[model samples]
Structures are given as C-alpha cells and as structure tokens.
Target: MHTLFSSNILSPPPAPATQQNPFELLFNSAATSNSTASASNSSAHSSPIEYNLLTRRLQDERRATEDARHVEPTAVRRKGHPKLLLMGQRRSGKSSIQNVILQKMPPTETLYLESTNTVKTVSMQSFAQFEMTEVPSQLSIESPEIAYSEANFRELGTVIWVIDVQDDYLSSINSLVHTAGFLAENYPRVHFEVFIHKTDGLSEEYRYDAFREVRQRVQDELSDVGFGHREVAFHQTSIFDHSIYEAISKVVQRLLPQLPALEALLNRLCSTCGMQKAYLFDTASKIYIATDASPTFLKDYEVCSDYVDVIVDIKALYGWQQPAKKPAGGSDADDEGIGESVVTFERNGDTYIYAREITEHLSLICLMGKGSGIDKRVLIDYNVSLLQDAVVEVFKV
Candidate 1:
C-alpha cells in the first residue's frame, strides 16, 4: 500500500500484517510464491494446472505491491520481493527517492525528513513485497556477512546509485567505482542506473555537461575496475518535478506481469467510453500505474498529471486529507466523506475530468471529449461504474 504524507500503516493492519508486512496489497493484487507458500500449506498438494495458476497469481501479487521495506538477507537467497538498494553517499537525495516513492512524502516534506542514521530494513505492515533499504554512506561495505550473503548477489534487481552533481565529486566517484565495480563483476545480472540528482536547479547547459562528465568519469572508473562490459543508464532526476516518479514508474513497470492485462482493461474502457485516454494512477506520487494503449504524447501525460495535481490539492484543502472532525458519538458513515470528484472545464477545448475512488490510495483519472450534454454525462458515469467493477474484479484475484 502507498502511505500518505506522514504515516506508514493504516489504523490497524489485518491479521499477520501487524507482525510482518505482507508484500501483497492492492498495488500487488496477485499473490507471490513466498506468500502463497506461507499462506496455505495444502496448496502445494494441488495438481500441475492448479500449481501453475498459483505461481502466476503469486508473481502478479508481488508486482502489484506499492512499496516494500528491506529485510536482512539470510545465508540463502530466498524467493521474495526483488530488492532495490538506494546506493549513495549522505545527502545524495536517496531518502527523497524513498520517501517520494514509498511514503508518498511530498517533495517539500522530504527536505525535513530525518537523515537515515543506521542500516535498517523497512517493510510495510499490510504486506511485505520486495525489500528496500536506504544504504547510507557510513555502511560497512567490507563486512563479511553482507559480502558473503548469497542473497546480496542474487536478489537485487537494480541499484539506484545517486550522484549529487552539485556536491563534491571526487569522493563520490571513488566510492562509486569501488562499490559498483566490485558488484558488476560478481552480480552481472543486477542493473546499474545512476541518477544525477538535484538537476532541477541547474541550467540546461550545466545539466547536460554535468550528466555527461559524471557519466564518463563513472564509466572510466568502472573500466579501470574491469566492470565496463555492461551499460549504465543515467537520468537527470529531481523530486520537485515528475521526472523521478516517471523514471521509477518505468523501472517498476518492467516488474508488473499484470500490466498488460491492466492496460488492456484501460484500452477497453477508453473504447467503451469514447474517451481519449485512461490511467490508473498511484494517488500519492501521481504516477500512472497503467494507461490505455493509445500512444501517449508528452502533452497528454502532462495534462493528466496536472489534473491529478488539482484533484490532490482540492482534497488536501477540503477533502479527506485529515480525518473528519466527527460529532460526539459519531456514526461509522460519519467518517466516510466524499473523497472523489467530477469536474468539467475548458483546456484547449471543453474537457471533462472524472476522478473516481479506486482504493483508499489509488484513483482512476479519465479524459473525456468536449460534450457536456446530459446524455454524455450519463454515458461517462455509466462507463466509470463499469470501470470500477472491472477494477474490483482485478483486486479479487
């Protein structure tokens, strides 16, 4: 589950969720192998077809999870949520990335987030998906336990190394070469994607030059360390804009096996509603989990993202950003208020934007044509209902 600005778990998580965060949540509606094995022991006795279904469902659920905290690696590499280690020195914007994606912390709030002072594995309560750890600079990389653990070499999918381009560079480069190059030689399968972080403050020329010069230096260091074989993808990332979220979304989409099915459903919704496009966005981060197959132009994505920002801003102002101030002896429904909205406006032309509640943390955003007649409104509402039903069915799995 995606957490809100200042919280982690719900009021009370369900069952085992309190003790150990289960990885599978609405984000990962499907189940994972480790979870399934742990869920029902009797499942193992099922037939081949049944087992196949179970495995696929587990994998799907793993992908659906919004964010998972890191767990200590055991001697053996157990099947679990794929690991994503935020590797960088102090003040490299590592926590910003984690808070932005995991806690859904506002970019501004991240400025005040406390610096991680120790090595700790953070996991969600409702489910434990893949593990994530904010690897601070002070970590002892030379520790034999961590270096010898098979899980360290086999489980990680990506190491998001951050480079604070505006900061002192010589020390960061040396650390990058020693740490990343050693892993490249052993963990050839692990991907290396670097972020030239905090580039929003740089001019275009500086941004390009910084990106290029830093990337080349890292590459040269890797080559010197005999890790030049594999390519390292680089990005200019900033928590202020949608750049980091978009980059993380691309990294995560590769892990979602249910993505095609979700996209197909969105495509069907678009056709049925006669809308231009549809997106299932992770509400906190404002990143679209899935979108219709219609080719996405930069302008279209920007428009949808901006509309989502408006919805969030309104919700923050008057909606459920905070718990309702209930009357004494309040009824259960009293706590439930209107968290969804439907509004129409002009942008290039008369446009209709409908925001529907998908989950407590997810929402459906759609782009409708200029028609505002009564009949057109009904059609839009009708299709939205269908879309919700489909989503419910998806969650049932």
Candidate 2:
C-alpha cells in the first residue's frame, strides 16, 4: 500500500485523476494525455545525482591543492633579490646617501633634506637590482620594531654603517660595535660594512687618520667581544666625489653571487680583446657591478664611471627615442624608449675608452691601449656580441 513518496526520493506525488474515474469520460479524452511525464521525472531526478558528483569533484580538487601547497611551500623571499641596509646615528649621511646615489640629487642639495623619523625604503632595479632600506637613527637593535630583527636580518645582504667624520663619531662607533656584535653572532651570512662618511671637509692626511682610527677601534672592540675573527670592510666616502660611487660599487659586488663568474668573463673579454680593463656598469646608478680581475685603480674606475654619465648626457640631448625592446634577461625596469650610445675617446694618446650598450640597463665600457684592437670595430663588436650573450646567460636576466 506504500506510495512512491514513502521512499527517501523527493519526486512529486502522482495526480489523483484515473482512467476509471467517471469525470474522465466527461472531460475530453485528449486532455488526459501525459505520455512524456515519466521521461521528465527521470531527467529531474538525475539533476541531483549530477550535482552531487560535481560537489565531490570540487572537494577533491580543493584537497589536492592543499596537498600541493604542503609539498612545496610558498617562498618568503624572492630569488636573486638582496637588500642593502643603511644604518647610523642621526645626520650621519644615511638619507643623503640614498638621495645622492639613487635620486641623482646634488650633494649640496642633500643639506636641505629633512631628517627621517621613520624607516624608509627605496626599491630600484636600475640600482644594482636590489632594495636599499634606510633605518631611522633613533631606532636601535633593542627597539621592538627595529628593522634588524632576526626575520629581516635573514634577508639582508649587507649593512652599511655610515659615520659622519666631521661630527663626534665615538657614540656612533659604540652603537655600531654593539649592533655589529649582535648581528655577527646571529646573522653570520650578512656582511658588515663601515662608511667613513662626509669626508669632503677633511684633508687627505686627516682622511687617512680617520679611516685608520675607525678601523682600529672597530677591530679592537670586536676582538674584545671575542668576535675578532669577524670580517668588516671599511671604505672612505664623500658625496662630493666619486668615492661614494666606488664604495657603493664594491658593496654591490659583494652582494652578487655571480661576481666570480662575471669577473672571469670580463678577464676573458679583456685578454682576447687586448683591453686594459673592462667594467660592467649598472646604467642608472653609475656603479660598476663587475670589473676585470686586474687590479682596479681608482683613477681608471673614476674615468670609466664618468664616461657612463657623459654618454647618458649626450644621448639625452641627441639619442633617438625608439620604443625600448625587451631586454634579453634581468629585472631592469621598463622604459618608454631605449637610449643607446657608443662612445670612444682617446686619453693622453695611450688609452682608448670604448663604451657601448650591453643591455637595456647595463653598459660595457672597455679601456684599450693604442693599437690594442680599438680600430677594428668589427672584430671587437663580434667578441662583444659573445660577451653580451654570455652575460645574459650568467645573469639569466
């Protein structure tokens, strides 16, 4: 006696009309027809089954995604990205360093820069393809919100401590000592660099003395703290001259994991091309990321670095503005137009400075002696082509 509704299914109940009913005879026989109703009920019942299958499929997919996430966790840091931290006491040229080096601001103009009361970071791919973070002078390692926490220190490649030479720097040295000791013990991978800054006002002899004094004090203090084995690099810097650029170039080189490869490639280029020296420069920052294995003379580096500026300046005036083509490889920022320049100038009739574009944001500047294959532009270009391809491979730009 049970009807279809007695089961768990949700199909609608049958209508009450029947063929035996007397009302069926009074109504038109054609109006009683419902021949397709069984097919309709079957299709309607199949919908819920299909929906259940779809729901199960979606759940399986979500679970698989979670498993994959667990198998390969998401990365917290980007590959090939390093951060350079600028830290020191107030008015120690930390902010000025960023302004002069990254913003192309004049050294004199930095005098008017307001004090940074909070941590600030300037991210640039054109500047060595890394981030430069400036820590407020008031913040210390003990500050709860200090940027040098263990988590952040793990991401840092180098920390440049700027000490104003003209000001009383003893307190600065003390702070640097404590900070360095802490970091050296905790973050052994991070490099410690000291910049004897604002030396534009000091005489040559005083500069040397100041540099020695700072080095000695740091070494002695670190040794007393039982970290005598720790390595710290010292550089004399002034925004008014090329010293800052040179120091920064060294810092950037240390951060590069492929520096040895780049240097070896440059050595090959220099030897095969009979060039005295070769520099791979970051176009925007005027910082040479790599150079030949040969000893680097400050004068030679200064000349080469200045040549980058000269080429860019001349191009700014006369270089054609063509749509910038995609670079071979690297994270150089996109530009509206490509600025290309090839410059050669003879110095004292002995050294020929040749510079040309290697990539959108990189330049290869070479110093060739007279008769060192400078006149044969075609051969040099071929060798440089190989170098360009190799550079792209090395940086995987």
Candidate 3:
C-alpha cells in the first residue's frame, strides 16, 4: 500500500518572515516531540495542554484597572473584553439568538423568553473570550445620547442586528439602515453583522428570497446614506438548525487577531497530513475558530459540527470524569481538562473523523479519506501533536 503523505510533502514553502514564524515554530516543535518520543515510549503520557492565554490576559487587565481607579466592576470588565452588540427592532429575535446560541437554551424554550427591556450583557467563556450585549429593540436610534451612551459602540467588535424574516420586515430593514448610519459616523471600526433570523418556518424558496431581500435592502439603503463603502456581513440564521452556529463562528473569527496565522497553520497541516478539512473549534461553544483554506461545503461543516455534539453527548451520558488532581498549592484552578474522540465512517467509504482536545476550550476536528490508512495512523497522530504544540505557541502572550 502506498503512503498518502510522502516525507517530502511535509516540508512547507517559505512564508514571509513574521517575528514569530508559524511554520518554523511548527517544524521545530514536531522535531522536538519526535526526538523525545523514543525516550518516553514506556513513560506515562503527560496531561494535555490548556489554552487560556486570552482569559488570563483579561483577568490581569481587570486587576490592573481595579488597582488604578474606582470604576464600576462591570464597566472595567467591559473595557478589555471583545464586545458583541446585538440590536434589532421590537419583536425581532435578537434575544432568542443569544439565548439559543450562547446560553444553550433549547430552540422551543426561546418562545418563552421575555422581551429584553434593558441592555443585557453576558460574559462568554470560550477559547476567544468575549461579552455579548443585547440591546432592547425599544431603544430608538434617533436618540443617540440615550442609546449610544449606554451601549458604548466604540468598544464593540461586532454589532449583530437581527431581523425577523417571517414578520413585516421592511421596518426592520429601515432600523438596520439607521443603526448602520449611526455606527458609521461614530464607531466606524465596529463590524456590522445582520442575521435574518427565525427562518425555519419559511419554505426553501422563501428562505432564499428573504435572505436576498434583506441583504439587498440594507445595501441599497446604506448606499443611499453615503456610507456605501462600509462593509456589512449578512447571514440567514435560525435557532432550529446549525446555520446560526456557523454564522456565529464566522463572527467570532473576525475578533481573533491571530486569524491569519491560524488559517495559515491549518492550511499547512491539511496539506502535509493528506487531510480533506481541519477545523480548530471552540468545543464548549461549538464555534469553529479557524479552518483550512480549502473550499468549505455545507455538508462537511454540518458533519464535523454534529460530531462534536455526539462526543459531548457520549461524555455526558457515560459520566466520563477525569481523576481528581490538586496542584502543589492544592488549587484545582490549573486543571487542563483535556479529552479526545475519533470515529471513522463510510461517507464515501473511506472517510475518517478525528477530534482531539487542543486545550481546555479548543478541539481540532479533522476529516480525512483513504489517505488515513490503518498503518499510517501513527504518522498522522504525530503531525497532529505538532499542530497542538504550534497552536499553543501562537496563542502565547
């Protein structure tokens, strides 16, 4: 049998020299692991690495701000966190989107979600830590002092404007246009994201039509206002399916400063390992942090995301728990909380899906085909271990 990835295939081409060259770091890490593999053959495997650099940095910043002044704790926390502002017209499904996606509330349960009367902020504890603030629809954009003063759009990373597709959405589009205008004049750096939400009940044809209509209206209106060049992203989402998750994944990725490096790394990993697709997912939130540059098909993303759900369910159902461990200081705060799962299925008869915990919050899910032969599994694992180490290195403060 022929090997899928020849030794020569692993050598990556020279990338522009950044201060921290990811390719150089990846190869060096892989070499070091290979050097130690034989010596540690009989030794117990060490605990998996935990990636909490972002969280730790935020905590440190919070502490620094607290020591310097006497400000509201909430305001201090908001200063450093990646802020996701959710806005829409009254009765639009903004709260439902947050409740279902971030809070893990069931789709049907969102029906009982009382309308958010005030600005509500929730801290998202994920690989990319952020705060999601939902603005009440009743708050009008015409009054900047009232609405703009409270939300502090200058600090926002993304503004997600939700529009209910099933309702009379013309007014919703108008509100989005006005909001975009306000942001354009004052907080130009904040990214605008529109969610045509609650489309599960619409027919397939209507769903597509509604998506196009909302997008076109927003574009035309924005252009009419002189903010024509402003970039605005649009997505059709529903709490009932994986669309919302996929949309949010794209949004969160925009907030990651290391996105280019992560994408470059995934591209190298896939090319070197003979893998079809690879996603660095924030497992706790089911949002992919990055993926290989290869064209992404909907079916592939759904399968990989669903596999994460399956792993989580199995762990919960089986009550899989790690052995208790305490550090020298007797504190459990430093636990790595690592896990892994792998399954090969016959999608096209030779496909394999592999999920390995990259950190306390991140997991790498890979889709491979015939190249992942039984004999070559060891080689593939070695390459993945290299990816794990390189990823940790990239996130280093």
lDDT of 3 by residue, 1-397 (tens): 1232223222333222333321111211233333333213211221111112222333333334334334433332224546788888877888888887778899899889888888888876665565788888878655553355645754567889999898898998887899899888976767899998888989998899889988898899999999989989998888888899888889987666556546655766776677899999877778898887788876788999999888877765564354334221111122454466678765565678888888766889999856676567787777777777667755652
lDDT of 2 by residue, 84-175 (tens): 88999999999999988877899999989999998888876663456788999888866766654567775677889999999999999999
TM for candidate 2 is 0.74
The ten-residue window of minimal lDDT in model 3 covers: 42-51
C-alpha lDDT values of all predictions: 0.61, 0.69, 0.69
Q: After superposition, how far is residue 387 of candidate 2 from its true place, in Å?
A: 1.1
Indicate the worst ten consecutive residues by lDDT in candidate 2.
20-29
Ranking by lDDT: 2, 3, 1
User: After aligning candidate 2 to the native by TM-score, how far in Å is the CA of 363 from where it should be?
Assistant: 0.8
Q: After superposing candidate 3 on the true structure, give the runs of residues whose Cα lies further than 4 Å from its correct spot.
A: 1-79, 141-151, 317-338, 346-349
Count steric clashes of candidate 2.
Answer: 2
Score residue 179 of candidate 3 by CA lDDT.
88
Error of 3 at 49 (Å): 30
